[model samples]
Target chain A: MKELQDRIRIDGQVIGTQTLKVDSFLNHQIDPAFIMRMGETLADKFTQDGVTKILTVESSGIAVAMAAGLKLGVPVVFAKKKPAVTQDSETYLADVFSFTRKEAVQISVAAKFLVKDDVILIIDDFLAHGEALNGMVSIVRQSGAKLAGAGIVIEKRFQEGGKKLRAAGIRIETLAAIEYMEPGTIRFAQN
Target chain B: MKELQDRIRIDGQVIGTQTLKVDSFLNHQIDPAFIMRMGETLADKFTQDGVTKILTVESSGIAVAMAAGLKLGVPVVFAKKKPAVTQDSETYLADVFSFTRKEAVQISVAAKFLVKDDVILIIDDFLAHGEALNGMVSIVRQSGAKLAGAGIVIEKRFQEGGKKLRAAGIRIETLAAIEYMEPGTIRFAQN
Candidate 1:
């Protein structure tokens, strides 16, 4: 966690009060060693929870979730951004608002992947509005799988997404939580 | 490779003709261990190439690319399928045709992550028409990065992608190459 917070401090770029561009190492361009460390740490936190599956939304979250899945020896299910897998009967659909895209996108997982027997751990790269986590949670609920918790690489605390999920009784873990971001300054929450 | 071939034989679902539904383990729901094995195998295949970076398309490709990055102790830069990262001065863009979506999509990578000194190893989940890989190769060429080659999880040999890329002198390593796929059977290329 200290390493993540430190790396974020040096590499995180805050833009327009809401956007944190970490593409240099975290999401777009990945530091596999660092990302896997984050994942292993997340896996360490939930090792005893009997989490049977790791879930995330595409494009970015796949790396982290898959890393966590590697550490846990479990499988990862990433919700599709394009919803192409739905042509067959192998999907569980949930609508998520893509704040960046300015549209609601339907993210889905195969229905067979998340059954009543699964204990799902939802993971992602950022937690701004909590739209993506809730979408994973929605799919888990629909599948009758147990919600284990959520792990995030970075959480923008000012956005209220992290707080709202915590208020909903969802256990959440974030490697780096940003407390404040102005035109030039960025703050990380003290653990 | 044996493990991968075995897993595919049991888990892979063949659709009408071209679509091999591997979401159960390869893409939608992923076996991190298996994928990382494929990644390690890919890493082994390219250990002599001096690959400085792992390149992939967003969504499904990020996981395997990250796995290869982990094994090689390098970084992965995924091309964005949605073109969201181009809002700044950080991207080199390329156009790709999404055969599944039946649309032309623009994929971009942050310019800072790729440079002329970089030797890129492209990785992906499937190779059917090679549209995605060609898009990535275009980005690599545009960035002036030397392409080391490509690593594919599964290659449909019946399709022209693998043959075309190999013919173009791109070094390709596929975990399993399917020779043919009919309604009731799937034959793998005999290595």
Candidate 2:
């Protein structure tokens, strides 16, 4: 977690008051081994809860979900941002509003991938408003799968998403939490 | 390779003359270890080529690209199918016609991710029409990067894409090449 926090402090960019862009190593351009360590840290927290599958949204979250999936020896199911040509119509669907993209998009996972007997751990790159995490949680609940918890690489503590999910009785673990960010200085939550 | 071939034969859905859907383990619902094996197989093929980066298109290709990046200890950069809010304007772009989706979509890589000094190895899940691979190759060429080769998980030999790329002198290694697929049977090209 220290390495991740250090990496974020050194290389992360703050676009505005809330945007903590860690794309240098976390998303856009991926450092596989370092991200894998981040995933392992998440797995260390949630692997004991009888998680059968790891879930996340497409594009960015795939890498983190993949690292956790690989480490936990579980299958990773990423909800598609849009329906594919080959995607079946019978799917558990949820609508998620993207602050960055500035629109609502439907995300889905095949019904067969999530079943009643499995326990699911949802992971993602960032949790500012928590719309993506909630969308995934909605899909997981629809499948009758147990929501083990939510894991995040970076959580913007100033946002209400993380606080809301935690208040809902869901166990959420974030590798790094950003308390505030200014032009040149960024502050993190105490361990 | 045999395991991959076996997975396709057993779980892959034949949607027509050429649409082999291996979403059960390759794309939608991913088997991490299995896909990692496929990536390792590609790393085996390109490890000696001095690849500085592993490249692919976004969505599904991220998993295979992630595996190869982890194995090769290099950064993996996936071209975005569409521009994101965080995406840079200066990019290397190419248009790709998707046979499955029945449309041409523009894909791009950030200018910083691909540079003249880098050595790139492109990898993907399927090589049916090779349009996606072609688009990626164009981006790498635009960057003036040295293209080591291309690695594919499954190549539809019946399609002309693989043939065309190979004839043009691009080094391509496919884990399993499907020669033909009927309603209930599928055959792979013998090494």
Candidate 3:
């Protein structure tokens, strides 16, 4: 966690007051050692919860999810943004209105993947409005899976997503929480 | 490689004539141990090449890329499909026409992450038409990077991608190459 916070502070570029671009390492260009370390941190945080599956959204979250999944020794199920060409089955769909994309897209997971009696932990790269997390939680509920908790690499605390999830009685763990980000300045929340 | 071939035979499902769905453990829902093994195998195959970087596309490729990156002790840089709001700098963009989606989607990678001197080994979940790999190769060429080769988890030999790349003198190593697949029947390439 300390390493993550330090790397974020040193490398994360805060853009336009809210968007933190970590493409240099976190999401796009990845530091696999750091990713592995991050996974160990997540495992240390959530492995005791008896989590059965690690769920995340498509694209950026896959790397982080895989890292955490590797450390936790669990299967990772990433919600697909694009529907599978062969998929035409009745599925659990959740519409996540992306604050960044400025549109709502339906993220789905096959019914067979998520089933009842499964404990799921959701992980992602960034948490802003929490729409994606909300979508994953909705899918978990629809599948009758237990919500173990959520782990995020970075959380925009200025945004309401992390707060809302915590308020909703969901246990949340974020490696680095951005307390403030403005022009030429950034602040991190003390653990 | 035997384990991967065995896993594919057991878990992979042929959706259509072209697509083999290994959703249970390869792409959608990932088995951590298996992914690690696959990565280790890829690393073993490419260890002599002096690979400084592991490259792949976003979404599904991130997991396998991370795994291979971990084994090789290098960073993984994924070409993003549709740059995020934070991404606006000059990038090497390619239009990948997907027969499954019937659309040519643009995928791009930042210019800074990949340098002229870097030796890159591209990794991906599957290879069918090789559009994605081709695009990555193009990106590498544009950046003046040395392309070590590509490491694919599964390659559809019936498709022209593998043949085309190998014909183009690119080193390609696939864990499992499906030479034939019929309804309830599958055949793997003899190594």
State what share of the real interface contacts each candidate retains: 0.94, 0.85, 0.96
Model 1 steric clash pairs? B90-B111
The residue pairs found clashing in candidate 2 are: none
lDDT of 2 by residue, A35-114 (tens): 88988899889867999999999888988988899889999998988897777878999999988788999998999999
* Predictions' DockQ, in order: 0.80, 0.85, 0.87
Candidates in descending DockQ order:
3, 2, 1
Residue lDDT tens for model 3, B1-191: 88988888788887657778888998789898888888888888999999999899977778888889999999999988877777657788887888768888888888998888899999998888889899888999988999999999998888879899899999999998889887677789985
Question: lDDT by residue for model 1 over A75-157, one digit each (tens)?
Answer: 99888877663365667888888787688988877687889999989999899998988888889999999999999889999
Candidate 3: tens digits of C-alpha lDDT, residues A1-191: 77877787778787779888787788779998888777778767986899899999888888778888888888999999988887849678999998888988999898899889899999988888899999999999999999999989888988989899899988888888888897678788885
Preferred candidate (lDDT higher): 2 or 3: 2
CAPRI tier for the interface of model 1: medium
Worst 10 residues of 2 chain B by lDDT: B81-90
Candidate 2 regions exceeding 4 Å error are none
Question: DockQ score for model 1, please?
Answer: 0.80
lDDT for A70 (candidate 3): 81
Ranking by lDDT: 2, 3, 1
Candidate 1 or 3, higher DockQ? 3
